[model samples]
Target: MMNIMRNSKHPVRTAAKEASHERIVSAAARAIRRSGYDGTGVADIMKEAGLTHGAFYAHFASREAMLAEAAERACTESAAIAAEAAASVPREQALTYMLHAYLSRENLEQVERGCPLAALGSETARQTPEVRRANTRYIKEMVDLVARQSPDWGQAGAHERALVTVATMVGTLLLARVVDEPALSDSLREAALKHLPIA
Candidate 1:
């Protein structure tokens, strides 16, 4: 009877722990995007999650583990946003709608809540293998998402076109963020939008 009673409490404890773990990951995801991987610290993430620093170990094996999960979360969020943008319009206009959303003024200013590829791509090369793997999955997923939007999806060159499209979008956004001049930034985005091979 005692053992049964004790075991019953395990589920409640596990649920609480899972909730805390989610909070940590969510906070870490935002922090990484807002501050970049090298700029984010475990202590800051824990504080952002409203937990004590010492409690971090209870949720993750190491800082790298937390970072890896955070990277995955950020990627998942960006992908969802892209999917939502694509879905908001008619099927024929999905790609254009998604492209506009990706390069919009709102996305340009909302780095913390925008695409991880544009915000973290430069820094990802220096990150740990685990973090890199998380980002790689996102890149693949984003490419697939773009390819599916192609009118010639499943054709020979569709995947290649998606590669170019994703690259162009990411590159355009990255450059737009780099320049301090607002006019130049707008021009860069405008050029990409005007020239992107939309079908």
Candidate 2:
């Protein structure tokens, strides 16, 4: 079957258009990562993406649509690893990688485009119901992926773990970026990872 949605009024994601759209979405993701959804404006996203403001409408109906896509994209980025990270280690180690990746200084510094949780959690709370649902599904999937390691764990177990992981990461990154000192930033990473593999 064909992807009718892919070929909607939106231009084709051909070799040419694909790169630009990817750039726009990735740029917007990065902006949201750095500036927060409300903080990052369309023009700023476009400029950061290296495209002009006029081109954004062609890719998305509005910023929410972009955020929706960004949320999906961010989840997609983490989903693959969620499985792989858990494969070799016990459930907790996998959790460490998943949570660690999100809360690290490397992630906070990148901003503009990193973990969706750190980049857009608050904004997502304010999003349209549809977007919120999408985010919910993404979070559930990630939780399930981690819970897989504990064959005995139930849905509630997975759900709570996922919530803790996502919350830990988001809060850590938020505080990490807020501080002016490098040690403070490293301290946040250490604090978040304290319960994970290293500690």
Q: Pick the candidate with the highest TM-score.
A: 1
| Over 4 Å off, model 1 | none
lDDT of 1 by residue, 1-199 (tens): 9999999999999998999999999998988888998899999988988999999999999998999999989999998999888888988899999999899999999998888889986899988998888888888988888899888998868889898889999999999998999999999999999998775
TM-score of each: 0.95, 0.70
Top lDDT prediction, candidate number: 1
After best superposition, candidate 1 residue 7: deviation in angstroms? 2.9
What TM-score does prediction 2 earn?
A: 0.70
Off by over 4 Å in 2: 1-15, 87-93, 155-159, 181-185, 196-199
Q: What lDDT score belongs to each candidate, Candidate 1 first? A: 0.91, 0.69
Instruction: Enumerate residue pairs that collide in model 1.
Output: none
Worst 10 residues of 1 by lDDT: 113-122
lDDT of 2 at 194: 82
How many clashing residue pairs, candidate 1? 0
TM-score, cand. 1: 0.95
